[model samples]
Target: MRHTLKTLLLCLLLPSAQVLAEEVQVAVAANFTAPMQVIAAAFEQDTGHQVKASFGSTGQLYAQITHGAPFDVFLAADDSTPAKLESEGATLGGSRFTYATGALALWSAQPDLVDHSGAVLRSDRFQHLAIANPKTAPYGMAATQVMAAQGLLEQLTPRLVEGQSIGQAYQFVASGNAELGFVALSQVYRDGQLSNGSAWLVPAELHDPIHQDAVILSKAAANPAATALVDYLRGERAAKIIRSFGYQL
Candidate 1:
């Protein structure tokens, strides 16, 4: 212990000293899983800090937070969650920001199963259509809105398969448990192209905009690593990764 202390002291005194790295605990929305993983890797490389993340539906994470979970930061699937946290004094003042704007997509693992105009929903070509649980996921709510706009909500409700989170909804399609699913555009798109199968980008006009926001929890208000992670997310480096996954800045 003495030797370790001595090394720290010497490093502190040296001009070329490196700051001690810290680990930030982050609760992330499931729809952002892929991009956030990439961002976390880049953040650790650039800042020499560690990020430990947990991914779930925004509502699930929010519930855990309100129940005294020890998360340092939160990246929610909707702006409302963070705003509510801030209003309830659970977040650091002035530390909230929109990190990304998300878009919904109707995706299928089979390349030709979905069509350009999303007309497949009207046909009897499939038995199950998957969606995230609207009570827990914002993307699921958007999916419902799109269906209602098309005047198919009541008709499609009985055939619907509900996943607890967007990631699970995506898996339902990927695994063929459902023929198609509503998911984050980012899940099926990367580098300005479709990463797999087929997708119809849900027109933004069909649903309310999905503005995802990030915040530093009051529990981590004094943690430099938490602050650094938030800063790293707002940097150009992270923005590029986000855009690659089809999220809007």
Candidate 2:
């Protein structure tokens, strides 16, 4: 009787330990950090799986995935990267889906530095305006598109400070290295409220829509934890949390 009880306890604990050992590794876009962190926390609480996330420019993450970076999922700031991965067989076909739509905003740490009308971009109050590197960062591409649409690209080029990623661009302005910069709306918020800063939400008409996407890597489709993470992302609870972070569905 004692032996049978011990055997039963071991068998029960073994499956739980195996589940706990499973972890999903995700490569995430910088703009999605805040919401992803919240989503990850909630996922772990609701499910036993753990997620390890690495945040960076979508372009950089794409390169890493192509070179076999061991990422189970790729959450990009734009649809292009995930689409590319799917086309190249790096991701599971048909697994790509738009997760969020990001918004761009001109932000400044200084009070009243940026007006609601975004007149500060044309003002001489600041010598430099930080933007992400358009060639690499999706937010940078959007910023460039906005400037071009407003016919300010040529004029603003001379005063631009380029950041490798949107997060870095936000840091440039937040640290006062640049008086104002274009950043993701998600970065300026905490618990659904804007942090200490002045900002102007750029109109969507100013640029192409930022349709963020996520995909399961082809190599990880069989990974139980990876599949669970993807399912969690599509579930109602995760979607609600993402929406609360200023992301558009």
Candidate 3:
């Protein structure tokens, strides 16, 4: 009789638990796509909350938010965008935090095309090099910074190809439209190693730190799932997943 009663209570409570689960709409920076995908899966499994992420360049995403896109949470590639949103009162106060530090990598689809020291940039072997648009992508800005620091920006300018976002820039290289390109280290790296192709991990000293931040938008101030997702990102499990994709916590 007790077993039957317990089984009946379990059946009654299961539907309530399912009903309590909520979905969070997230705007994520393109560079974080892989790790976010992994993290989102884990978050959903653990908390029963669903994450729906839209990926794009940070600047583009910020523009959408300012134009009233209905995103509950934003994970940006740079700290500035989130700060800008906060200053504009578009974000929930005290709900912002750095989630990752991004690194730049010069990548080529061909193996051994890029050397560890990135000497290929100074060479004339490649006709075109791709970079994301500096105006909208933090990685693209960092790529320019790296070139400038190496005194190759002016010389390489003629050979440059621009992409709307880092993902597109990477695609340019992968598709051989550009022989090489600057991309997020996370995109080419996984599990402590390069996933494929050849890459030169740009030294962090060549550019300003790319500190990625996450924030809860004002539109999601009342969203429990939004808050929960943000909290989950700060946890060790999420940190581990972020690190696996070559991002610094």
Candidate 4:
């Protein structure tokens, strides 16, 4: 009799939960893919709202949005793109904010290949360093700035391979196509630490802070789920996850 009563109660609650659930479509920056995936899972578990995350370079995603992509939210790798979207009427007014401050890391798949102070760039001991396309990726631009500051940009240009996105650049090193690369700290870190490989956390002064922003799109104006997801991002749960991945919230 008790089991029958519990089953009846469960059946009654299921419909209400289903009615409240909505899926949110999110366009995420490539460097933020891993962390976003974790956050998305947590969100679904906590609120029963499904998150469909699509990852790409910020520039590519911005172009797609302008051309009418159906993403409910846009998480850009830099503040400028969100600002541009706001100016172009692509975003819901006053819906944008900096979600995280990014950090760049010099990483090598082979342990001990990168040093703490980034002196490996001067070593010239390895060839074929990878970076994202500076034209489309903010982290790539920051990497260039860091190289230039060290007076190594021109010197290392011949050895550089550019990826379409930070994920691709990370793959270049992870797959052994390149000896090392400059990638987002979040890519190689979790729980405030790296799992494997050698990495040098770049000096913040070497380049401008990569202030990543999130905005609700104009297309999602009617989406309560989209707004809920954005609010979740700014909440304590999301902030803790972001920090775990070495990002500043």
Residue by residue across 1-249, what tens digits does model 4's lDDT show? 999999999999999667544878899999999989988998889888888899999999999999989899999999999999999988999999999999999999999899899999998778899999999999999999999999999999999999999999999999988999999999999788887899999999999999999999998887788998999999999999999999987
lDDT of 1 by residue, 152-218 (tens): 9999999999999999999999999999989999999989999888889999999999999999999
Deviation in Å, model 1, residue 152 alpha carbon: 1.0
Cα lDDT tens digits for candidate 3, 1-103: 9999999999999986765448798999999999999999999999999899999999999999999998999999999999999999999999999999999
Q: Model 2 shows how many backbone clashes? A: 0
Please, what is the TM-score per model?
Answer: 0.91, 0.91, 0.91, 0.91
Model 3 CA lDDT for position 228: 94
lDDT of 2 by residue, 1-249 (tens): 999999999999999767645789999999999889999999989887889999999999998988889899899999988988888888887888988899888899998889998988888999989999999999999999999988899999999999999989999998999999999999996667678789998998899999999999998866888889988999999888887777888
- Residue pairs with clashing backbones, model 2: none
Predictions in order: lDDT: 0.93, 0.90, 0.94, 0.94
Worst ten in a row by lDDT for model 4: 16-25
